[model samples]
Target: MKPEAHYNTGPNELYLDVRLLQNLSGTAKWGKVLAVLGFILSGFILVFGLFMQQMLQSPGRAERVADVGLSGFTIVVYAFVALVYFFPSLYLYNFASGMQQGVQERSRQKVGKAIGKLRVLFKFLVIMLLLFLVLFAISLVMLGTGLSDFSLQ
Candidate 1:
């Protein structure tokens, strides 16, 4: 095998450098902000869902909601939305914190974990989007079929 032809094909190390660190720092800061905002939004949604009854207690509010076909399940839907929004926020927060720590300490392991979390977040979001898309398509198909059947009758 002729001693394997020793050549230094570089891919062994990645230089972080100051500029890259700065950029990562900026991204981490934004991620933290977005995470915090997401958490707050989820909290607001949960609170609103819980308090939906009280909010709709006024004169015709309940009637209007009922007329719109959102009478009872409003709270459930809002709670579900809030719950769905919370995980991505949590992942973003963890990624941001880990990335910041990694940048500060120049730790590859920390950065890798942070990136892993980001990947998880993206995967989660994409899966959720796909589910929602499918759900929407199914709903539309059902609605169209129902309307056509009604029209035929």
Candidate 2:
């Protein structure tokens, strides 16, 4: 008699193989660490940006405008870079869950899916990063021109 393969049917009956689950757990841990770091860095950028804007808006603050603007731009760029990975990492997490369930159920469809999905996910991440870079460049240009207040009397 041929043995029946265990398959994870759906959410209610999801199962995960021990080895695969371990691997996924490890992957998730690293990903989570990255997410936390990104969040922290983004927070710093936001706070610094606020401070810069405050300084720029204050009377006689124009004296320091050049340095503050440069620093603010750097912070915004860093935040944008951090955010670039946000959505794609979220997708990767979903894929990891799917993979875990597949392994547990020994589902034929789940076994090799994560590998392909990761490639696609990474591609999307890179594209997002590129988009952020372009937007950042635009922001720098706009800020440079709008804040240019050199006066000659």
Candidate 3:
């Protein structure tokens, strides 16, 4: 059964005005655009990574890559990076979709789900940021101690 008292006075309940709905709609549109773009870019990256090994089969590419201390593993890393890029874009898309539906239907549950997806996306970004920071610190320490040569080589 649907509640007929959508406009009832509840202190903890949120009231979405016209302005808020417009804003949400706009945000959702933008988010959808960016997510689609991200998906396309990630697809390109994965395709490139997969075909890189075949490219290396060509004349001098493998030798050049070897000279740079890179090997077949580098292709795997590219694909991994692409996969990493994909999840956040997916989260953003889900958030956008949920928000749009919630606004259209005036469904608080859908909006809440959208917010949850956004929160998860942020948490994932923070974790990735921290991991990169730690890696940067380690790299700096290695360089300071003149151990970069040993590590890289």
Candidate 4:
């Protein structure tokens, strides 16, 4: 008979190492910086979208109904993109804040909440990555079909 290895699984054992805490603190600072940058970028995108819409609707330009509709669609797409960027940043910011507070106060609940926010951010990223991959595959298929249709005699 083989002897079983003993393992220490006490509830009082430290789950987080000191090194990890240091790293997390650094990450929180960077996250704050990134979140601010994302907000700035979203603002710029919003301004550009509005500017584009206005340019398309300017009285000096002879705008067709289709052109106006297209501009509106473009603005909508821009808004969606801006929202996508904004949301993840918001989550990241929250995580950073929670982690900072948790560490400062040595509160387990705050740390858990911070981890939860991080999970949400990761989930959103994974979904976006999958969506982009699917879109890329579809584009490749479309391009291949389009190229096939343009063969010279």
Question: Which one wins on lDDT?
Answer: 1
Better of 1 and 3 by lDDT: 1
Sorted on lDDT, highest at the top, how do the candidates line up?
1, 3, 4, 2
What TM-score should be assigned to candidate 1?
0.80
Q: Write the per-residue lDDT of candidate 2 for residues 1-153, one digit (tens) a residue.
A: 334355525543445657766876677556556656655665666676667666666677666777556535655665565466455655566566656555566555664575567677788978877987999999999887777743321
Alpha-carbon RMSD, each predicted model: 5.4, 7.8, 5.2, 5.5
What TM-score, computed on C-alpha atoms, does each candidate reach? Answer: 0.80, 0.47, 0.80, 0.80
Clashing pairs in 2: 15-104, 16-104, 17-104
Question: Per-residue lDDT of 91-124 in model 4, one digit per residue for the tens?
Answer: 8899989888777666677788899999999999
- Can you tell me which runs of candidate 2 are displaced by over 4 Å? 2-17, 63-120, 129-153
Better of 3 and 4 by TM-score: 3
Question: Which 10-residue span in candidate 3 carries the lowest summed lDDT?
Answer: 6-15
Q: What is candidate 3's local distance difference test score?
A: 0.86
lDDT tens digits, residues 89-115, model 1?
999999999999988877777888899
Q: Which RMSD does model 3 reach against the true structure?
A: 5.2
Q: How high is the lDDT of residue 143 in model 4?
A: 92
Regions of candidate 4 where Cα sits further than 4 Å from its true position: 1-20, 59-69
- For all candidates, what are the clash counts? 0, 3, 0, 0
How far out, in Å, is residue 104 in model 3?
0.4
Quality of model 4 by C-alpha lDDT: 0.81
